[model samples]
Target: MPEWMRSFGRAEDGAVTVDWVVLTAAVVSLGMLAGVAIWGKTGGAAKGIADYIGTQGVDTTPM
Candidate 1:
């Protein structure tokens, strides 16, 4: 009913900001998901490599 309230209701700036916030959140969420997936795969591979290296004998004799 007030003049300021009517103008605020018709404003478009806040709407654009809201859209951008939602889009950014979606992108960040996807990145996190990809990171988690990659991390799981790499974590296993890393552990395997560590185990292999740990089992190898070290030759310390001078050539």
Candidate 2:
């Protein structure tokens, strides 16, 4: 084989960039999933809080 072909086969330094890209993509996907889950819960939580406040017998009418 030629010297250049042997050199290409022996090189290992470029793999780190690929590994970092994959890791970053995985982290971003997980973050988006977490945001979706949290968003789904937010409305329910707000409703619960409002219900609790309403049950306290305070007048809900605006001043």
Candidate 2 per-residue lDDT over residues 1-63, each given as its tens digit: 999999999999889998999999999999999999999999899999999998887578998
TM per prediction: 0.81, 0.56
Q: Please name the candidate that would achieve the greatest lDDT relative to the true structure.
A: 1
Candidate 1 per-residue lDDT, tens place, 1-63, comes to 999999889888788889999999999999999999999999999999999999999999999
What does candidate 1 score on TM? 0.81
Clash number by candidate, in order: 0, 0
C-alpha lDDT of all candidate models, in order: 0.96, 0.94
What lDDT score is found at residue 62 in candidate 2?
A: 95
Segments of candidate 1 deviating more than 4 angstroms: 1-7
Over 4 Å off in model 2, which ranges? Answer: 1-13, 54-63
In model 2, the worst 10-residue window by lDDT is 51-60
lDDT of model 1 at residue 23? 100
- Pull out the clashing pairs in model 1: none
